[model samples]
Target: MSDTQGKDGLAAATGRFDAALARLDQSLVELTNRVQRIKRIEVDTQRLVQERARLATELDKTSARAKRLDDSAHDVSRRLVVAMETVRAVLAKTE
Candidate 1:
């Protein structure tokens, strides 16, 4: 080939290479951004999971306390009924 043709060919090849490099750099930047977003999402998910566990534990304790209170109320009601019956019986005897 002539020298001018060779120079033109080299210049075309260099332009194509530069374009490809630019595309590669752009892709790398996009990939890095995506990875950072994924990391943030992972951290948020972990935080939520921890919060859920804490709430579950709190719920369990509350349920246990409620059950204890309910049992105590039933016991008190039973005693009150017995006392009322006893008082009625005593009044009847007096009469």
Candidate 2:
């Protein structure tokens, strides 16, 4: 081949190589950005899981307190009923 033709062929090959390298760089940048986004999502999901666990603990504590209150209320109601019955008996005896 003539020297001129050889030079033109080398230039065309170099241009194609540069274009391929540019496309590869762009793809790498996009892949890096996607990995960053996935990491952020993972962090957000962990935070949400921690929040849900804390709320569940709080709910369990509230439930236990409510149960104690209900038991105390039931005891007080029973005592009141017994006192009323005693007062009625005393009144009947006095009469």
The candidate that achieves the highest TM-score relative to the unseen native structure: 1
The weakest ten consecutive residues by lDDT in model 1 span 83-92
Off by over 4 Å in 1: none
Candidate 1 lDDT, tens digit per residue, 1-95? Answer: 99999999999999999999999999999999999999999999999999999999999999999999999999999999999999999999999
lDDT tens per residue, model 2, 1-95: 99999999999999999999999999999999999999999999999999999999999999999999999999999999999999999999999
Q: What is the lDDT of residue 68 in candidate 2?
A: 100
| Model 2: pairs clashing at backbone N, Cα or C within 3 Å | none
How do all models score by TM-score?
0.91, 0.85
**Model 2 bad stretches (over 4 Å):** none
Query: How many residue-pair clashes does candidate 2 contain?
Result: 0
TM-score for candidate 1, residues paired by index? 0.91
RMSD of each: 1.1, 1.5
Each prediction's total of clashing residue pairs, residues at least 3 apart in sequence or on different chains, is 0, 0
lDDT against true structure, model 2: 1.00
